[model samples]
Target: MHPSQSQSCTAFDGHRLIASGPLREVAAATKQAIDAGAKGPVLVFDDQTSLPVEIDFRGGVDDVLSRLGLASAAADAAPRGPGRPRLGVVAREVTLLPRHWEWLAAQAGGASATLRRLVEDARRGEQDRALRAGEALDRFMQAMAGDLPHYE
Candidate 1:
């Protein structure tokens, strides 16, 4: 979901609502959840708290509930662990050539490790872009300070 549309709801154990706010606001809430021994998934919403956009825990519901000292009585309980990062609703599977697969295999020690590295690399690149953008904005503001005509 778009960052602008992202919201989050934080609950402790299972039923206690700690906070509900925008995704950006969840950073502080996440720390609070950790502090409060909340080991379950942190549910994210799109625009409404009643409907979840994403769930992040990475340890599975059983593990999360165990850590939080809660029980899942519902047989069809939502799996708590971090859900797979969805690209979008219309995801298309790409068939890699054998050589391409071989190359990726060679780079990845294993499939899991390779996937992890790819994700980390992508995340880092995004962070670097943001940093550079911020720097550029700072430089632009500094350069415009004395050059721009000001009234009032």
Candidate 2:
């Protein structure tokens, strides 16, 4: 399935949340709201990043899905070509110093694998920090809640 098809989305009719679910369902609901003459400007948001999503809401639901690459039926019927999309690996240029390149080349899995490992390590470190911060917040909330009457 296309990435967009799997991604969760939310639609807002102004400040009100009109729909939230798979992109296709959200788009359908957004279309319905628009067709019913929504009071405010309708906006769709990508749930992952909490970012506004731009979707062409032209024509019917099927057309909208096709335009947004959210039509699972069509995607399933299509033939896939070779490349990294299946592996979820996107290739992009990375500029590094000569010494950095030499060090990466000397690693057990070569440059790509070493870079990926380093990135994963960094991400893990960030996650650890976030976990600790969340734990602290939870403790603080528990302490504060304890002060209230009938606290559990």
Please report, in order, the local distance difference test score of every candidate based on alpha carbons: 0.49, 0.73
Candidate 2 residue lDDT tens string, 72-120? 3345455555456765655575767899999999999999999999999
Alpha-carbon runs more than 4 Å astray in model 2: 1-3, 72-152
Error of 1 at 114 (Å): 0.5
Residue 95 of model 1: what lDDT?
A: 53
lDDT of model 1 at position 133: 64
Q: Which candidate comes out best when scored by lDDT? A: 2
**Cα TM-score of candidate 2:** 0.50
TM-score of 1: 0.31
* Residue pairs that clash (backbone atoms under 3 angstroms), model 2: none
Candidate 1: stretches off by over 4 Å = 1-92, 142-144, 149-152
Residue-by-residue lDDT tens digits, candidate 1, 11-47: 3334445566644344345545765687554444333
Q: Count clashing residue pairs in model 2.
A: 0
**Per-candidate alpha-carbon RMSD to the true structure:** 15.7, 9.7
